[model samples]
Target chain A: MDNIAGHKSSLTWAVHISVALLVLLWLLPTLGLLVSSFRTADQIAGSGWWAAPFPQEESLQLRTAGPDEMTQDGDLYVIEGNLLEQNGAGDLDISAWGTSARDVSAYAPGKTAEMRGGETMTLEEDGTYRLTSAEAFEGRGERVFVSATVPPEFTLDNYERILFSDDSREGMAKAFFNTLTVTIPATIIPILIAAFAAYALAWMDFPGRALLVAAVVALLVVPLQLALIPLLRLHLSIGIGKGYMGVWLAHTAFGMPLAVYLLRNYMVGLPKDIIENAKVDGATDFQIFTRIVLPLSFPALASFAIFQFLWTWNDLLVALVFLIDASGQTTVMTRQIVELLGTRGGNWEILATAAFVSISVPLVVFFAMQRYLVRGLLAGSVK
Target chain B: MNPALQGVIIVVLAVAVCVGYFWSSNQILDRVIFPAKGEKAGQNINRANMVRPWLFLFPALLVLGVYLAYPVVETLRLSLTQRVGSGYEFVGFDNYVQMWNEPKFREALLNNMLWLVVVPAASTAFGLLAAQLTDRIGWGAVAKSLIFMPMAISFVGAAVIWKLVYDARPLGQDQIGILNAIYLGLGGDAPQTWLTIPFWNNFFLMAVLVWIQTGFAMVILSAALRGIPEETVEAAIVDGAGPLRVFFQIKVPQIMGTILVVWTTITVIVLKIFDIVYAMTNGQFETQVLANYMYDKLFRANDWGVGSAGAMVIMLLVTPILVWNVYNARKEMR
Candidate 1:
């Protein structure tokens, strides 16, 4: 008995440790991007995001105040200031300093380096500096290379540039609104259409109802890839062309199968006695559907709404074919991010910030109403 | 006009129109067309009930027919015909012959097969593992939520997130990309540009999907696992089965049906995957999947014949699942 109990306790510990490891592995990639979005471009280039919270030692090249700032003191020309303080490193602790890039930390902080022209320079760990020349300093300020330990810094500048800047190439503000334009109508219209249809399929005794239900089931797995060219041709010929109306219609059509299927399934499960009672009360089919059936199917309605909203918001292929024009005026967030990936592939800061802005809205919806989303998935898939 | 303003106007107008249609149509039917008054009131009520379902079903059926059902037939016809000057000519399998001859098409076919196998399997395994393990611990809901969070992110958004992980820098500078950082830390001689590597880059792209989908599988599978009857597990324990034995031998067998359902659903998703590959590699470096390849042929190459042919190929791959789902649904209905 003791042996069995001992083994059980050990297995419990194993489960905890394994779950922790799995969660971390799953989260690390997204966490990296989330952390990277807040970091400066230089910090991202200098180290990994895992090392973001702690102070990091970095090498910086700074020029002293130009020769115009040099002063005459007791037959020596001198420049006095803090090298780190001058360069936004006021809080940094300098470990070493050098004049050449090859060996950035040749001398300890607070030590003086003898110059070629009978000049000497001293930099202290506290970031203060002194440059003494027997002759007057000339030309640009002397270049000082210093290795300093910098405190962890986070910035919202990347978000500012990506979201607010009017620069056409990097901005996502336009695309964000475009996505909203596509998603809202695309989501609401379908539920309205599908709810009525679903009510009929569930309650109304009509011929070929079984066939129609099967058709919806079959359409559920039909890849929307098949719809692209034909729909585009139809849209162009019908004068809707490639714009918001075309995309909205296409989404509504494509989303109809799932919307109808989920809602019908949920509505079918409603108590049959209520509809019979309503019928006995002389309420017509339309009245029962509008009054009782619609309200009772709220959970199903909410689930399908969340699904359609997320799918439309995240979609790229449909928009690519039906919405965006050559003018690029109707570009959505997903399309904009893809464009950024091609144009600014190496700029992690812009990419991260842009991706996050696009992802944040759906994330909010997902977290706030996760129950409905999960319920929808279960009904949509498990059946 | 501002698109946002246009959106608001459209929403209000759309809601008003829908409400008006349902309300007015129902009113007209009950009051005028088939008034529930006079000597023939019973007959009129029966007639209105008979016609009302069709009225409710009209818009949905019209949209479905034009948008989805017609597209399948039209795309198939377009595949067989060549676009010549402003019109189409029936070329009879020429597009398929040409697509078969193209090496890029073959590469895409092979890569899609690989994606179909790897993504669903990996996602299901990870999801099941997460589902089982998380179910056993305290604070599991938080862990499940974090894992499930990626499903909310769009494919393009996920592409950017993974691109940051797979980022490459020169050897001497500090490596910011997590993958390269780990590779170098483990004594790799130089940082590898993961997405540029030819054959293996496909796996790198598939990782994005697996990351996004595992949460979905975990959510569904976790529910299935919880739904398992506790007495069966207790029975296995009383029989002296170990934890691993109980999991594989007892619990998994019961949930096999749910697992298969999860698998096929993901398989359907995998077959139509586009945004991830389009954003990450754009079918470059032999990473072409069928959907992206079709996009390339249709938009970039301007050859609608081959593009529609490629679309048909996707449809063909999906047909078996569609049939199976319809069959299962019909069976359950019966």
Candidate 2:
């Protein structure tokens, strides 16, 4: 209100710098993971993601083509080949060369290292190597150690392997589809059920409405841990064991409290005149709800839909208890990522890519509909 | 049938069932049971109107009761008994006694207390700072969105992101984790295994939550800050209050209720803090929280009695908040 007196340029600069620092602090972990997801496994293992944009100096153990591919030149048994291609890293530059790991990188490119038997070997900066021996070549090619500078490299190969590869254990394609299956119905069913309940609680005068509303509010915080065994037992006894239908039902129940609470709060705030006018026009309560109230409650509905969608998509506990069984046929992305974390703990490439794949959809939804999401959050919390 | 195709069919069938139930029930209420054009049209209409709310409420309450309400009681019962061969044997207080003696349970309880105290305070403090700083600047929205972006990520995904951040490499190798990178850059001798350190690793896991929750606290508190009346702030400034003074002495007291709301909301979430701990450390290295501890007992150890007892501990912890919420709700209704 009065920036005239208190606003200092230094303080403003401090605020700016502080905010930037905080923002970077908050964003760095995710940025690191996102950057790592696109990097090759070797690159990730060799350097941090901060150093990803620069050439990474790595000591690679490479070999030339075996003696079978060698051709004699000038009565010399010769093996000429690109060491990088032979080692499966074709896009790196040989910075230095050596014949032994102890003195790896001792010889510069275009330099020759003397052999014990009056033979010689020279490595070019472009990874071309020539090995000249006086006698016939042996069964195996010479082992060479090359200090190569791998340029900044990024690839969709990580995503491709995680998302589209045929390796059943590594692929996330099934889990992605399974998450969508669990999320859509779970999101849609609850909103529909909650809308009708919300309308009744908001507008219609029924006995025990206040108590019912209080119950919903109280249920909002009940930890789903309580529901796991009992509900699973219920589902099992009712012949709806660990499966899709069971998960959908469990998610719906778990999400109902917030749905009814949020929608009721929003519905209660609507202009009273329009609803009264609609009712006075000889329209039934159903007509009024379907026409006037439902349309008017669009923001609240959208808000809860996003909430429920995000909740169900990211949920693991409910799905673990009610959906997944020993068969492991239907695993959602979050659960799948956890399993990957256990089995593939050291494989950052797979972990990061799988996580980003799981995180991407919600991030898109979050940014696209943040206005509604924020509105829902405020309404849900403020009341 | 293809699972994707099955999903599509289930979605379609679910929507159809819900819509059909609503339409047919309402139609039955109006046309068959209580015809509004009959001789006692007004009485018939009153009867139908009385029943219509239940018609709307039936499915919700039924589902909530079966799926939420009854489970609480059942879980309570399950905690009081042990499962025999094919049936359950009632063994009152034995499970709780078992849980009390288990060192892991005590460890989980203590860690949860630590989490409960630290996460909300840190998140709310940082959120208040962020809200205050970002409220006036030009690029504040951008800054806010970046801070808030973590809210969208799944706990498992965040676990991965942070796991990478806290990743430790050998001293000679390049440190992939930025934390270790920064540590080594700052003249530290060797890289620290951030998550493997016993007592401090709890803070490391809690850092992920505080990171995610700080944005939420910021958004809510920012709104509350905006809703602070301009006149009070102007009067405070006119009376010679500085920026920090005005924020604390004037704006803060007014918005304490919203702050508490955000605090308790985060508290509720922290009480059930399983996913991050489960995904990151799996309660290893003395970082066990109650929810994850419960999951371990129930799922891994195959002991539902002790698991239900653990769940009851969570419920008992939340009972006060639940009662307070219901009371406030009733008061608001009145």
Candidate 3:
């Protein structure tokens, strides 16, 4: 689209800026979740994820070491500690400090606050604090409030808790495995089934082949909500029941139309010369399909596999209906994330981590096989 | 056995069985049932060819019919019948009547209409914009993939992502949600809980769909735009058509068919959009769409009659597209 007139149209910069903005808009949400998953619960609640890379300025409440650590020095009992050092936020720089909640941040760092019991507490910007009194400090210690700017922190603890937790109910490991269990068979079986059907429709001389193809196209847009009740009843009555078998069958059935549609579309485009030459060589239709056409239709098959994998893996409704039971044993990642959303709505650490775990596989597949995905989209929508 | 090990074994076994079924059936037809050798060898071969396509198509056809085709009819039947004790009695139109009377269903229908209008149009417009703009830039493919990235993320995942965007905290606290922070930053009096606000929240929900689907629209429309006749575009520009004029008048008109395809494709997606509504709002706060409504009737309320009726409504809405598609396929066949 470069200007042949060589006038250097001003629209180019406008286009560049617009695309930059669009890319950022598209990337920010997932970026936020990815950042949040590496943060702790307190960090998420304290500030928005957009501030993740910057230093966090927060107010902290800390206590000096107990009266047991006190010593008499020149007619005074004293306790000394660094609030930031004790809390392990040694990177933090205190901006303000105070001795009571009512007067939080009443003084700048290094100022001393006079207590009612004739005790004096002095805090410095480096978080070092001194507690001195004529009598030894009582109970715990003098409470001090510090408003400080702490350096950014990130952690792998969220992943550890979600993936390696002892309780199966809390961890994502089982659901992750269950999702894989549903996805792999659902992907592979449909390709073989759809490929054979596609080969038949594409090359075979048969009555009603066109009608079957049209029916597949019609079935392409049939919303699966209509399949819910009837299929559930079928599952229960036939004793397929809500588990791995039932969900796999449901996924296969649901994925069949597009599988056949995409594969047949690609297969039909396969040159007539090859199939006819194979037939002329005395190869069976089965041989022609498996030997020549199956290998030839790799792109279409790959496209469908990725589609079925993502659909069956990310599926919540189908899993909810046919796979997941009241026992929560057959739960998949999507279902687990939804459950987290319900029970741990405010727990962004868990929600973000589980959501990320659920989406990460699809994202990996998506980026890796994106070419096939896009090609499938273009081919599938051609008609 | 450990559950993971059990899952792995089942996966292995299932794959083996499916493969075995395909291979053994074809092997049986060839080796045992109709071996292409005999006194009537040609006859056997001819018979074998006739039976073989069905063998190829049988598994897929069986699944399509039993899983997809039967459900359309069965769901239709359930809609007209009321459940009795261990049986169903035919009561035509009663279920539809009950479903129609519910305020929630009405709200759902209204909201689905809103979605149908907004999501496809907004997605298409933005997609066209992205497609056109990116082509004029050097880093278009990189930008397009980033836009298309959301298509891979599940709807539940998207709901979680957007929930954070629409998240709100009370005033006088550091607002955690991006929208809230922006709202407060822009000097809005209070942070709006975007999802809970009525009348406008639907747009917030729709924005998530828009954000996700714009990539799809962009990808399809970008291809369509690339497929445009360069000569025609050149001729348009030769006549002093401005850039916008060339776009709206020339480029868009040529790709109108693809645009319609993108629109209809997204329309189908919008109709079946369940996870977003289910996860974010659960159809509360006047955000009920028909799919969620049907789910509510079937699962939560345990009303099969009305649930089936709701399903039929969605089916009815889709019938026109099905007919159009079948008609198109038949036309293409001829």
> lDDT tens digits, residues A107-211, model 2?
999998898787799999988889889987777778888888778899999999999998767789999999999999899889889999999999999889988
| Runs with alpha carbons beyond 4 Å of true place in candidate 1 | A1-6, A73-76, A100-103, A106-121, A132-139, B36-40
Q: Who wins the DockQ comparison? A: 2
Query: Deviation in angstroms for B147 in model 2?
Result: 1.1
Badly placed stretches (over 4 Å) of model 3 are A5-9, A116-118, A133-135, A167-170, B31-35
lDDT tens readout by residue for model 1, B313-333: 999999999998999999989
Local accuracy of candidate 3 as per-residue lDDT tens digits, A138-223: 78867788888867789999999999897776699988888887888777777777888888898898888988998999999999
Instruction: State residue B196's C-alpha deviation in candidate 3, in Å.
Output: 0.4
True contacts kept of each: 0.84, 0.77, 0.74
TM-score of predicted chain B, candidate 2:
0.98
Q: Fnat of candidate 3, please? A: 0.74
Clashing pairs in 3: none
Colliding pairs, model 1? none
TM-score of 1: 0.96
